[model samples]
Target: MTKTFETYSNIQSQNIRFRNRFGIEVAGDLYLPVGYETQKNPAIVVSGPFGAVKEQVSGLYAQEFAKNGFVALAFDPSFTGESGGAVRNVAEPVMFTEDYSAAVDYFGTLPYVDRERIGAQAICGLSGMALTAAGADTRIKAVATTSMYDMSKSMYLGYRNGYTDEQRAKLREHVSQQRWVDVDNGASETGHYSSGYHELGFNADGCIVTGESLFPEKLPEDADPVSKAFFDYYCTPRGYHERSINSTAAWTATTPMSFYEFPLCHNIKDISPRPVLFVTGENAHSRYHSEEAYEAANEPKELLIVPNADHVDLYDQKDKIPFDKLVAFFTENLK
Candidate 1:
């Protein structure tokens, strides 16, 4: 028999839409904790893990936070999941930052939410996006990230390792050509870029065989291990959801074209005074991202690691997640 878990409590959830500054309506699920007696409670806006939908990790995080007494929202970024956008699977770095800011706007207007105590959390690639937003807007009282990705750096440097300038230039050219094709054809192709390590039947190797290979110099000492875990997360039912862009074959080719040029941490140091927390697995492939961002950020910043865990492990492994720590972090800071 399969084990069943009650994912949510007496939580009341609603589907709502909020428009960004660009007038794009973004879809989200707002979870109101039970016993809400018209009292103003701290609100948290949660998103990310890159191509993932709200139904996946973000929703889980929202539900958990709601149960813990915060008004939490899990939203789909513009152009992904149930959010509004013309081209599917497209990622705009600037628009993504705006998405978080828009969520703050929505939260601020809610009667039951303590507008001044609003907090934000982002996972995977959106982590950097949240930081960028917090740096610009003081509305976000506190910010936290999990399995974070410095998207701009990742685009240029490849993965946990690093990439060469020549290789990055080549990738930019390829994506640029693909974007032109999309414009000419009036539609972009949908599919995965590679079979990943799991699909290719290499459980241990974790190498992506079907997609464009990484530059030889970008491979890290632990690249194989991290790749294996990522393959398991994106390929297996454990973390896979049909609405997730990662579950699908490919993303809009133009996404990389824009991502390569976006600079996420240009003013990162400005997020100080307000606390910033970076959480990643000790054994995660992407822990270095948190370390780097923590170093670049000023004081009132902290980096927390979940020992013996991988990147995907932080996605939904309830037992391993430090819920109490998170609650305490937000509570103290958002106050």
Candidate 2:
């Protein structure tokens, strides 16, 4: 059984499973507010921050939302954690976005949930996928994102759009060649692009695989600030969970292939009638992602930045997360 990373006195949680459109069984923890059985309540489907499982940050958010009188579901996306899918640790953009809608489907069947008032909160990398789902599925009445990271944009343009034309071409060339190699080898290889932050692991047919563990047992003296911040949360008992990909494993080598072609939130304008709330740390490296998304989004949108906080700080830092603002946004819009 997966351990509960965070819990609240006013909330009750139960393990649940539901199938997505593709028939993949998705696992989730359903958190109900103290008086949930008495009447219908607004709901939120929460997940994200890339490789993390539902037991970590998402679960905490779900519990918090439940404590505040909203029925919330924190789920593991397909192929990660307890969710079912072939070839573990693969990151498929289409399926990931579909998971949000699947969560909506589950909530709509619950007598205690107000389907029309349902919303979603996605953290980190899953923010993009959540927004994409909101754009396509009108069921998600309101959407919010914290510490947003557009994986597609990051994969295509590199961190801070640092990749030059030649660099992008070379990376794409390697990825294409790697696909053929994987087909011939009869297995998906694990590797990461040279851009952004990643620890090096074993070599597979000349590909430098991302490390198995996101952080080492002991911190290295020369670890960069970004890696250090992530390490302090995911590697420590404060936020660590064995099933989380961010805590224990790396994504498959070719996972970035589909992300390169598909840009998330390309249809940000489609979610106009539905409100969007973008929250990020003022000092977070990924603050730019929320800013870019906010600029592209139509009216009925908000961008909230917490002072003196970094990217990972928003992951589990209760004091800096501005939960009141999040609750107010959902309450005002989901009504």
Candidate 3:
């Protein structure tokens, strides 16, 4: 018979604070299982979906991991959520990767954590960040990602539909101008300019309607259905949060500037020997990301498709999350 681990009867949660290498204070929700003991238990660091705060998906993952006998934390990255940074709603590729490394550092110091057994899981854009971390930091023993987004590719080439070279150049020019404006103003600036929607001219009373004009015209045939799934996730209340970057206006115009230049998969082969798990929905709009990353990663890797699931379905859909597999993956590897 399989051993039945007792559910945590009185889990304790608290707002915890830690700092990155850059001295930026990172805030996170720390969950502790009931009857927890300081036996140096294995721990997992969870973050991302990018532009999302710990209060959302990351917190949920942390809580689930804690329930299964692990020390887990979900943190807000610098410049977003409750974390410290001068400009808000900005995304920095380097600093974001540093944030993951910082989490590993914090986990290493905790009295109740088995420092050597630290693992990480990043979702969405943060999955790319996790891959960056796994390659650079040997401290991370095992890594996993769900619904991964190759931010670099998405920034330069658009989504799965891809972008024209002319369109990409125009985007670069737009970001460059925004950088100059911010430098001159000496303060963060915000306002909508020419986004992918404006290029298509599908304005419908201030909202960019996503019908024939937007999706069918610009998106690839294979991506139309997937884009619909992404639309449901971002536009609906199902996973929408006031703090989600997707639910808000485009990030500070200059945010994409750095993303366009940074190639995220440079050292992917370094993660070899250490197992990597890529999880994506079978019908997810972003399944290609996991597939590409899995293909590029070296030996000791896995690609898992949640059957019949869509891209957003893996987010907070308890029935489709494959918790048993996740638990077994981490438990077996962390040992």
Better model by TM-score: candidate 2 vs candidate 3: 2
Query: Rank order by TM-score, top first?
Result: 2, 1, 3
> How well is each residue in 1-335 modelled by candidate 2, as lDDT tens digits?
35536566667899999999999999999999998999989999999879888888999898889888999999999989999986787788999999999999999999999989999999999999999999999999999999999988887787787766766775677667767766777663533322222222224454434444556788899988998998888777877788887777667666777888888898889998899999999999999999999999998999999999999989888999989999998999889
lDDT (tens digit, per residue) of candidate 1 on 185-271: 655354322211111111234321324221222335666675656656665667666677776554554566566677897778998
Candidate achieving the largest lDDT:
2
Pick out the ten consecutive residues of candidate 1 with the lowest summed lDDT. Answer: 194-203
Q: Candidate 2 — which residues are off by over 4 angstroms? A: 1-4, 188-213
Tell how far residue 93 is off in model 2, in angstroms. Answer: 0.9
Estimate the TM-score of every prediction. 0.87, 0.92, 0.84
lDDT of candidate 3 over 265-333, digit per residue (tens) = 678889988999999998887899999999999989999999988877776788898778888889999
Q: Model 1 clash tally?
A: 4
Q: Whose TM-score is higher: candidate 1's or candidate 2's?
A: 2
In model 3, what lDDT does residue 73 have?
Answer: 84
RMSD (Å) of each candidate, 1 decimal: 5.6, 3.8, 6.5
**Best prediction by TM-score:** 2
- The 0-to-1 C-alpha lDDT of every candidate, in the order given, reads 0.78, 0.85, 0.75
TM-score computed on alpha carbons, candidate 2: 0.92
